[model samples]
Target: MAFSAEDAKTASAVWEKIYADVEDNGAIVLSRMFKENPHTVSYFKNFTQLQSIPETASAEEIAALAEVRGHGKKVFSALNDLVSHLTNVDSLKATIVPLAKKHATELKVDVKDFGIIFENLLHLIGQKQGGDAKEAFEKVTNLIYEEIKAAY
Candidate 1:
């Protein structure tokens, strides 16, 4: 289903707050992602650099976390653009097509991987803004997943 203009507005506003939090805590998100699916990290050439730190992280671990955070910023920057243009179907298609192609072909990302990421993302959003925001995310992310799956 196409997202309504109201949905787009809600999503755009929610994303600004969520993206800010995500940009700051991207490493935690990545850490959770890696913990749940270690194989996902293999897609990154720098996966080996990640430190297995818990209570007390060393300098190397800190650096690795920074790297993960940097990657998060890049990902969310794209997300910011996509969300910002949710009301524009042409713009959305332009962004998702190339991104989906890279993900499907170069990264060989499975559809299931998108589900996992979205699940965690929604959970994070739920923590921040409760049900309405998640409902908006649910609609938008499903649309994104469908678009990506089509390209795949």
Candidate 2:
């Protein structure tokens, strides 16, 4: 199933809540949410604080998390193509990069932001959870796209 605007809103709201919580406390709300709702843990990445102790996550940790998520997406997409076809699989990057390139002039944000967010989402799901979760992430991306459309 494709993602809806409401789905993006929900995801963004979740993200904002998690981010704000991380800013205010040392804990990640998403991680805690998973512990509280173990059944739904599949929806978010599990991050542990292993470095210097602080009341909240450091900016470096946040940046590293984002990088991990982006890298995870690239790996997940490659794996998906490999599993789907040994010789004639479609390239997710090729498909998505051109779309960003084509619409670079019209997007409200930088074209790279679209790719970065998409990649980050994928990375978070694939590496933190499992590669099988890419479909779910794709649905969320589709929902974000729909929401973006409605906005402008």
Which candidate's TM-score is highest? 1
lDDT on C-alpha atoms for all candidate structures: 0.71, 0.39
**Candidate 2 wrongly placed segments (more than 4 Å):** 1-108
**Which lDDT tens digits does candidate 1 get at residues 2-118?**
568888888887787888776554555555666677666666765435644432544235435767778767766777777876777777888889998898888887767877777
Q: Which digits, one per residue and each the tens of the lDDT, describe model 2 over residues 50-146?
A: 2221235453443345433453344344333322322221333334344444444443344334444455445554554466455544555554444
Best by lDDT: 1
Q: Quote the RMSD, in angstroms, for model 1.
A: 3.4
